[model samples]
Target: MSAAASSPASPAALTSSSRLAWLDALRGIGALAVVAEHMLPWFVPSLRPYWFSLGVYGIFVFFLVSGYIIPASLERHGDVRAFWISRFFRLYPLYLAIIVLVLALAWWVPVREAVVRDGSAVAAHATMLLDVVGIGGVADTMWTLSYEMVFYLVVTALFLTRGHERSGTWAIVFAVAAVLVGLVASGAVFGGGWPAYVSCAVFVLGLTGVVLGRLRTVSACLLGVMAVACLLLSSRVPWLGAAVLAVMFAGTAIYRWERGTGPLWPVAVTAALVVVAPVWAIESGWWWVRADVWLTTIALAAATFAGGMALRGRRLPRVLVWFGLISYSLYLVHHPLLKYFVQVSGDLRQAALPYQLLMTAVALAVIIGASALTYRFVEKPMQDLGRRVSRRCRGGLQGGGEARVPGEDAGDDRVLGHQERQVPHGVGDHVGQGDTVG
Candidate 1:
C-alpha cells in the first residue's frame, strides 16, 4: 500500500487548505468599488446619475462572494456548531460596535443633533433587525444584512438536514420560486423593497449550483447573455432587474469555466468589453443609452470573475486585504457617518465642490478609523468567540454520538460510526451536494 493510505487526517487538517489570494484581491477591489460608489460626488458631477446605481452593484458582488465562500467553508468542517460560531465571531462583534458607535454619535456628538432628536431610528439600527421593520434612513445600508441573515439561517437548517435526500434541491427550487412569486406579487421586478430578497435566494441557488458541481458551461454562458440583456432592460423596466440580478451567479459559473482553461487574458478583455458595452451604447445614442447603468453592473461581474481568477495564489499587500476584510463594516457605517458629518458641518451637499470633497474625506477618515478599530476589537473577537462556542456545542453533539450509552454494549458501534461519518461537511471543503440531494 502507498504511504498516503497509512496516514489518516489529523485535527491539523482543519487549517491545511491553501488560501486563495485571488478571492482576497477580488474582495479588496470590490470594497474599493463600494467606497467609490458611496463617495462618487466628491469626484465628478457626471457621476451623479450613475453613482448610487453603480454602487449597488458593488454590494451585489460582495453577496455573490459570500454565497460562494461561505458554503464552501461549511462543506469542509462538517460541524454545524463550529460553522455557526465562526460566523458569529466574524460578524457580530464589529456589527455591535458599529451599532454602539452610531448610537453614541447620534446622542452625544453635537454634530448628530438632528439624529438624536429622532432617536427611534437609532434604536432600530442598534438591534440589527431594522430590515424587518421596513424602517429606512437609520442604518439604511444594513438592508443587505437582512438578506445575509436569512441566508445564514437557511444554510444552517440545510446543514442540520444534510442527510435528507432532496433538501438542497428543494431549498434552491423554493428560493427561485420565491423570487418569481415575489416579482409577480409585487407587480414590479425590483421596485418593491421585498422583491430584492429574491435576489438573495437566486444568489444562494446559483452558488449552490456551483458547489454541487451541477452547473453547465452552456447554460452558464446562456445565462450570462440573458443577464446582460436583462441589465440593459433594467434601466427602462426596473422589475426586470431580476435579469441583471442573475448576472452574479451566471458570472460565478463562467469563472469556473475560465479557471479550467487558464486563459485569463481573454477573460479580462471580455470583461472590459462587457463593462464598456453599455457605456458605448449610451454614448452612441443607441436609443437605449439609459442602459449605460448596466455597464457598471456587467463590468463589475466580469471584473470580479477575472480579478478572482488573477488573485489566485498571490498574497496581496496588507492594506488591500484589510479593506476586503472590513468591507461590510465600511458599507454599513460609511453612509450614516457621512450623513452625520455633512449635517454637522452644515449644508455639506450645498457647499462648493472643494468643500464637499473635504467633508467627504473627513467622513471617510472617521469611517476608516472606526471600522479598523471595530474590526480589531469587536468583529475579530466575536468571530473567535462564536467559533469557539459553536465548536464546543458541535463537539458535544459529536461526543454523544461516540460516547457509548451506559450498558448499551459495544454491539451498537456500527450505528454510532455511521452517524459520525454522516455529519454534514465543513463550511469550506464540502462539495455542494446538488440541490437535489442536500
Candidate 2:
C-alpha cells in the first residue's frame, strides 16, 4: 500500500474534513428530514407525524446555514464576478438538469397543476423566481430556489453598496415588510405573466452587467430591486416569502455577531418579527402556519443550528458529513423519485407494515444512491471547475471587495472540504410534501 493510504490522515487532511463537519452534519440531517417528510406520506401514511411540518423545519435549517455561510463564500474570495460565477455553477447545472428530468418524466408523473405551460414557467424558472412569480417549479421543492436566488442578488448588491455590514438592518427591514404585507396583501398582488417576463429580462441583463464590469453597481441594484419586488408582489403569501428572506438575513446577522463585527440584538428582533409575520396573514388557513406551530418549527430549527455551532470543533460522524456532501442532490431528487414511485408502484400506504418498511428502505437507498452518484459526477466536477475559475479572478469585483471587512477571514475553501459552494442548494418550502413538494 502507498504511504498516503497506510498512514493516518495528516493534520491537514483531517482539518479539511473536520473543520466544518458540523455544517455538513446539519445539511445531512435537514435533507433526510425533508426526504422523510415527503416519503412517509406515500409509502406509509401511518408513519407520518402531524405536529410540525418536517419539510418546513428542514427548509428553515437549510436557510439558516445558507445565510450563515454564503457571505463567507463571497468575502473569502473577495470578488463579485467570481462569487456569482461560483454560485451559478453550484446551483444552475443541477437545477436545469432537474428541470429537464421533470419535463421528460411529466408523461409518467403528472406535473403539478400550478406549473404554467404558457411559457411563463420557463420565464419564472429562468430567474429561479418560480414560486414568487406565481409559477410552479418543475419540482415542488424548487420554489426555495427563487428565494435563494433573491438572497444572492440582495447580498451582491449590499456587498457592492458598502452596506454588507448592515445585515441586522436588512433583517429587520424584511421582517417588518413581511408583517406589513401579510396584513394588507391577499394572494399574489402581481397577476399575469408580465412579472416573470420583465424580471427574466432584468435578471439576464443585470447578471451580464455585473459580470462584464460595466455599471456593475447599478446592475446589482436593479437585480436587488427585482428580487424584493417579486417577493412582495408575486409570492403565494406575501408574508411567507418576506419572512423566509428575513430568516436568511437573520442567519447573516448572527454570523456577523460571531465575527465580532456586529451586535446580537438584530437576530432577536428579526426572529420576533418573523414569528409574527404570518400569524394574521390574509391568506392564513393552513394549520402549519398557525403562530404556535410556526414558532415551534422555527425555534426547533434554530436550536438544531445552535447545537451544530456548539459542536463545530468536534469531529462529526463521517456518514453524516458524506450525506451533507450529497445533500443538495438528495433534496432535489427525492421528491421526483417519490412521485415516480407512487405512479408506478401505486400507493404503498395500504401495504403491510413490514412490506411498507421494506419499500421505504429500498426507496431511501435508491434516493441516496442516486444522489451520491450525481454529486460525484455532476456537482463535484462543476464545483471544482468553478473554484478554479474563481481563483483566477481573485481580489474580487473591482468595487465589492471594499465592503468585506479587513483582516477578517471568513472561510478556508480547502479546510471546509469544498462545502462553501454547496451553501445555496438546500430546502424549498412548497408547504411541505402533503400539499406540494418544493
Candidate 3:
C-alpha cells in the first residue's frame, strides 16, 4: 500500500470502531507464549530446549505491535495532555494493584530481598524507571516498562515536532547505532555506575517534557534527547535495547505506510534493519549465547507479526480475542503466581512428569481466572474511568465543548473497545494495546 493511502490527515479521519481482530489474536498468542516460556521449564522439562525462549519472542512481537499502534493513537488525539492522561489511567491502576498484591504476598512468601529493598523498590515505584535507573525490577517483567517509557518519550518528541512520519529514518538510525555500539562498546556498556544517576535525572526531565510538550517545543526536544540518551548510555543492554527500539519504530513505519502517512521505502529499509540488527547484535555483543537460538526466535517473532498483518482483514477466534483482552493482567500476574506456586509446591522437579503436568494445568487455570477478575474489576473499570476523566478534562480545557474527532460520537460507544483507539501514551495500549511488557 502507498504511504498516502495509509496516512489519514487527522485522527478524525479514521473509523473509531475499526477494530483489529488479528492484532488481538497476535496478542493472545504472544501472551500464551510468554506464559508458557515461564511455566514450561518447571512443568514440562523435556520441552524446555524446544521452547526457544518464547519469552523474548513474545515480547518482541508485543513491542512491534506497540510501535505500530502508539503513534496512531498520539496522532488521533493531537493533544499530549489527553494522551498522557489516558495512558496514566490505563497502565498505573493495574500496575499499582499488582505491586501492592505482590508486596503483601511477599510479607509471607519470601520474595526476593533485592526486589524489596527500600531504596530500589521505592525508587522504582516512584519513577517507573526502575531498569533505567539501575534498580532491578520489583517484578521480573518490569524491566521492559523502562524501555516502553523511553519509546513514549521519543514518540512524544516526534509528535510535538511533527516528525512522527520519520519513523523509518529513526528506525534505521537506531539499528545502525546498535550495530556500531555492539562492535565498539560491547563489554564496557554492561557495568552500571554514574549512568544510573544520569538515567534517573533524564527520566524526571523527560516526564516534565511530556507534561509541557503541547505547550512548548523546547520541552519536547528535551524529552527526545533524554530518551535517546537513556537508550544509548543507560540501557542495561544498550546494543539490544537500541535494536529493540529500532524494531518498534520499524513497526511504526509499517503502520505509517499501511496508513499512507509515509512512503514504503522507509518501511522497507526498516524491515531489513530490524531483521539484521538483532542478528548482528547477537553475533557481536552476546557471543556466549547461542546465536542460532536467538536468530530463530527473532525470525519466528517477525514471521508471527507478518502473518498477523496479512490476516488483519479476517475474523479471529473468540477465545484468542478474549485472551487478548485479559493479556495485560495475565502478563503481570502470571510470573508472580508462578513464583508463589513454586514456593508452595516445594521443589516439584522431584515429582513425576505426569503429576507435574497436572499441577501446571491447575496453575494455568488459577492464573487465567485471576487475570479475568483483574481485567473485569481492575483493568476495565479503571480504563473506563480514565476515558471519562480524559473526556471531561478535554472538555474543560475546551470550555465544556466536545469536538468529535472524525468517527467519535454519542452512538460510538464501541469506539474505545478497540485497543488501538486508545493511545498508549507511554507503554502502548492495553493487551493489544502496548501493555505487553513481559
* lDDT of model 3 at position 47: 61
Model 2 C-alpha lDDT versus the unseen true structure: 0.77
How do the candidates rank by TM-score, highest first?
2, 3, 1
Residues 1-438 of candidate 2: C-alpha lDDT, one tens digit per residue: 443344333333334455468788888888888888788777777877666767788888888888887876677667788778888778878878888999898787778887877988889988888878888887878887887888999999988888887889999999999888878887798788988898899999999999878899999999999889988888777787898889889888877777656776888899899888875642446766766777887889899998887777687889998888898888778888877776767667668999999988988888889899888988889888887787677655475434443554433575434443232222233333345332
lDDT of each: 0.42, 0.77, 0.66
Model 1, range 37-133, lDDT digits (tens) per residue? 5554433333454412445456556655654444434444454445444555565565566556656775643332222234444443432323332
- Candidate 2 matches the true fold with a TM-score of 0.90
**Candidate 3 deviation (Cα RMSD):** 6.2
Q: Against the true structure, candidate 1 has what lDDT?
A: 0.42
Ranking of all predicted structures according to lDDT, beginning with the best and ending with the worst: 2, 3, 1
Q: After TM-score superposition, what is the CA distance of residue 300 in candidate 1 from its true location, in Å?
A: 2.2
Which stretches of model 1 miss by more than 4 angstroms? 1-20, 42-52, 105-137, 163-183, 187-291, 315-317, 398-438
Highest lDDT against the true fold, candidate: 2
TM, every model: 0.58, 0.90, 0.83
Superposed on all Cα atoms, model 2 deviates from the true structure by an RMSD in Å of: 6.7
Model 3 TM-score relative to the real fold: 0.83
For model 3, residues 215-299, the per-residue Cα lDDT tens digits are 3456666767866776676665666678778878888887766655556576566555555554444554443235565667777
- Model 2: lDDT of residue 135: 86
